[model samples]
Target: MGQQTVNEPPVVEGPATQEFAPEVEKLINTVAKFTVLVSQKLPDDVAARLKELAEEETAPMAKMIYSTMARNQDLAWQLKRPSCQDTGLVQLFVRAGTDFPYLDRVDAAMKEAVARATKWSPLRLNTVETFDEYNTGTNTGSRSPWIYWQTIPDSDSLELDVYLAGGGCSLPGQGKTLMPGEGYEAAVKFVLDVMTSYGINACPPLLVGVGIGSSIDAAAYMSKAALMRPVGSHSANPKAAELETELKDAIDRIGLGPQGLGGQHSVMGVNIENSARHPSVLSVAVNTGCWSHRRGTIRIASDLSYELLTHKGVEL
Candidate 1:
């Protein structure tokens, strides 16, 4: 009989067996590094708005404060350090496709990246057990790194948004349930009240996020969703978009301008996210972003290649 040659089976890459390439892994690490970097450097648009406010600000103290903020932002970027010592807690909003090769391991990779970042970038250890009051030091523990996941169908890539929520900015987060009859006007009033009182404290030229729906929790979650919006973006619905614009103008008139010292700009913009509510109840929630708004986004392909979305043209 002729000698039979044996052929090795073809290699297959599955979710369990696939590994991210060296460059891809490096990209993930780079994201963590950039997260720390951007947290220190306010966006150009934000900085420009602050400058305008400083020029137009009538309050001497507020003008001086705005000038100091602008200077501090410049220095923080030049020094490549965190603008705020708190650095806040890290939150990741991930939209992953079921077919993405690294979907299963993305969470692990993120946790690892965060830990590496803590050591390399020196991010503050903000994760403390509520009851125990013990800091994790590494910023990675049970739910210490907040992640929100959404699965998309028939997609081959994953999109990740990183948000750093500071204590002061998050402190003004408020939500309430109202009777359906209260309608949108009531919701608007609630937001106005919050901004008039706590908005100054949140560091004006704030990005206001409003959520409207049923249930206090749902409204609150929607409000946070609003914060994910781009500075100048508006709602899809015409009415909602109009409300956003109106609120923005009203806030600017508040003169809470940069760092709450008072200026021409009280808010950078306003965004609203709404959902269908129960017949009997309507809920509204609000959250604010400080002047030093820190957020970044990246999208990864099925092959583990990625793109940075938040800071335009940023590679890795």
Candidate 2:
């Protein structure tokens, strides 16, 4: 992130003024465009890491697969098209400041952004209402494009983490509540069990996010949140960070490799995110991000200036 910051315009508490409505709409349109762009373009950090992995791989078949992946990334950027057919289920985590002027308009702006991206990004129709079972085509049905929000104590900017959770990865998300006596050791066992059983079903070189919290839902949310972290980033807690390294090494030994064809490594990395847990309940959850890991961060200034934090050469 750049230290150079812009002073946002004055904040209007109650609602965005009529004069600002069009400006707000402009912000929505810009978000819509970037939403589409992100699906088409892999983030810079991920691309760089993949390249490094490719160069390090020793097996000829594995190296060739990695080269093909690089070509796919290049072609996607060149043609401005999605690299994967599963454009995925969109999940947005937003950190909005309390002092921000357009709080009331955020939901509408984001919803419009998703809708517009469906057409312009040509996102696959991944949403369908339960029971009724028909694609909305618009990608806006019953919280189809899920948005998780957090309001900051005192800030005016809006920060977002966008995730494309494809069916392969989403289908394998695992959660369990372990008894206190089961301990963190059991939690690690559960993750290992899940990966051994189903990790390869999702793409390999997976980014494994382990969540430990008081309840299953809390653990699950933290697990997904962990996927937002950069590939090589580890938890601040020394114990957690150490466990991340251990687990990554252990899992990569399974040799699922890139796209599960067999290679030197099974995972890109492991990340653990935790919260204060109940003495009686130790809930653990695991969320696996695909090898083509589609995740990005963006910041929107109060004055509507934008920054694509996870990608380069993006304009808004």
Candidate 3:
């Protein structure tokens, strides 16, 4: 899948596409292409981890499911289509250098890129307005193609972390707050409970992201953000890293297996991201990425030259 290539350049041709300057237009084209790539191809890390998990399975049923997954990816690459039917609602986590020239245009360009990708990659129309109850049909609506922004000091590049949050994976997402006295064990229990009750629905062998903070909102954001990290990555803090390993072991012991059919392992890995909480309260949230966790990262220089960090050897 990594070696698969699309030679034809993606062209964005709406009334809005011509509004951008040459530089911003190039940015839009590059981002649009990368968005398509992210939907169709698993990142190198995810692909490698899937192979590792498949090797560890001893059950014939689990083994067969893994083989099916491998074939699914091959077909996705060969057909030049999304690996999963739910291409998911696009989410971009942007780290823009303070000096980056196109920062002002980044937001609009990102929306344009997603709109273009919807037609080109043929992404499913996943954006629906609340209460209004209608699909936007462009994979975009009010505040759709969600963007989370950060500022980078003394740099001249924009780094984009792309994620496809599908409905099945999003269904299990939850958050909770515990009094100081509850301690961290309660947080651990919260994670285990969520997994055992809802994990299978997301298709087992999940990539779990846990976030600890003082409020549900903060923890929820961090939890989803944690999914942007590569599978098998550990937190920099030693204790947090230990928690990752512990939770991974505990969840694997659940034996949900591939596609939740029951087998040797329940998760690809567990990742924890935390922020110092208020002394009075502790909040923890959980987010899961299904076996086909579609995510990627790209770095674009001020000149618009780019690097596909997560998908090495693949070009936009």
Q: Considering every candidate listed, which one attains the maximal lDDT?
A: 3
Least well predicted 10-residue stretch by lDDT in candidate 1: 8-17
Return the TM-score for each candidate structure: 0.86, 0.92, 0.94
Clashes of 1: 1
Clashing pairs in 1: 205-266
Candidate 2 residue-wise lDDT, 1-316, digit = tens: 8695534333322112233378778877877788788888888877877877888899988998898888998898788888899989888898998977788888777777777788887889887767666676667667757999999978998898878888998766999999769898899899999998999899877889999999999999999999999989979999999999999999988888888898988888899999997789999999999888988898888898889999878774
Q: Which pairs, if any, clash in model 2? A: none
- Model 3 lDDT per residue over 1-316, tens place: 5795434322434335348889988999999999999899999999999999999889999999999999999899889999999898999999999999998999989998998999999898887777666676678767877999999999999999989988998889999999779999999999999999999999778999999999999999999999999888999999999999999999998889999998888999999999987899999999999999999999999989999999999877
Clash number for every model? 1, 0, 0
lDDT of 1 by residue, 11-31 (tens): 433223336667557646765
Once fitted onto the true fold, the runs of candidate 2 whose alpha carbons sit more than 4 angstroms away are 1-20
Please give the lDDT score for candidate 2: 0.85
Candidate 3 segments whose C-alpha is farther than 4 A from its true place: 1-18
lDDT (C-alpha, whole model) for all candidates: 0.77, 0.85, 0.91
Better of 2 and 3 by lDDT: 3
By TM-score, highest first, what's the ranking?
3, 2, 1
